[model samples]
Target: MEKFTRLTSVAAPLAEADVDTDIIFPARFLLLLDKAGLGKHLFHERRHRRDGGMTDFVLNTPPFNEARILVADANFGSGSSREQAVWALADFGIRCVIAPSFGEIFFSNCFKNGVLPIVITGEAHANVMAAARTGQPFTVDLEAQTVLLPNGPALSFDIDPWRKRALLLGLDEIGGILADDAEDISAFEARHRVDNPWLFLDDGRMEQLLSQGDGK
Candidate 1:
């Protein structure tokens, strides 16, 4: 996962509510666990018509096609709690998504996958979307608690300190846990074998394993 200190780029407006995970990445494309090729499948159903032509989706536009930041409306990720929604968005080059609200499960999934789900006020969101639609680039400064819009004043927003740290360091729940006590893990494993001899059925098995490689 890549560190996400700050992101400055053109933000495309998706301007829709209750945009669920299934619409973000249709179930048909979930065949592959690896998210690398999922970008092409992002909004798979909506982007293409029954006649096999491009639809009127916001992402189909040229300016929004290469957008890195997405400005969307309330209840951004509402329906199913599929992790693939975050994967598809991140893989599609959308690093951050600004919305007034987000589905609980989808919000958590975003952080775990290195996508910053920014919750902003409705008024501020409108301002950002207007700028984005006009082809202006904006800067989201996580450290400064501000979003700078092109040719306009900066917009202030709030973000939880803990979430900010996770995004900045690119540390997911598992990554944070492991980084917090890597040394303690080694010590605990050593003590576990000694305290519960029967747990390690083979005698000296644990010690031999420890001696064969670096403790880490």
Candidate 2:
């Protein structure tokens, strides 16, 4: 996961609401086991026609193709609990997604995968959508929690302190737990071993178990 301190690049505007996981990365693409190469498949159905010709979608057009930020309407990332949606967005070089609201599962998955899903309303959302339409670049500063508009004004947004820290350090859930409490984990393991000595095998027994292949 890459640290998301600040991102300044062209934003693509998708003013449609309820842009679900299927629309973002169709279910057929989920057969892919690895996160690599999903970018090309991002918004696959919308970007391609039945004959494999490209459609006039925003992402298929110029300038927006290289967009690093996405400004979308409310209820962005709405159906299904697919983490691949985040993977596809990240692979496509979109570091941040600004919307009026997001599906709860999608919102949580974004942080885990290094995508910043920002919730903004009123003036902030309007300004970002306007900037994106003009193909102007905007900046999202996670540390400062501000979205800098092209013209002048900066819009502030809120993020949970721990999630913000995790993004800055590029730590996933397990990585964060280990980094923050390695000592505590070690201590707990030590105590567990002492309290449940029968769980541990002697050298002779361990070797026997290994030789048998199946521990039982």
Which stretches in model 2 have alpha-carbon errors above 4 Å?
A: 197-216
Q: Rate the local accuracy (lDDT) of all candidates.
A: 0.85, 0.92
Q: Write the per-residue lDDT of candidate 1 for residues 168-204, one digit (tens) a residue.
A: 8889888877877889998999999899976876657
lDDT of 2: 0.92
Worst 10 residues of 1 by lDDT: 207-216
Using lDDT as the measure, the top candidate is 2
Question: Could you tell me how far off, in angstroms, the CA of residue 122 lies in candidate 2 after the best superposition?
Answer: 1.4
Q: lDDT by residue for model 2 over 44-113, one digit each (tens)?
A: 9889999979999999888999998999999999899999999999999889999999999999999999
Q: Residue 53 of candidate 2: its Cα lDDT?
A: 99
Stretches of candidate 1 exceeding 4 Å from the true structure: 197-216
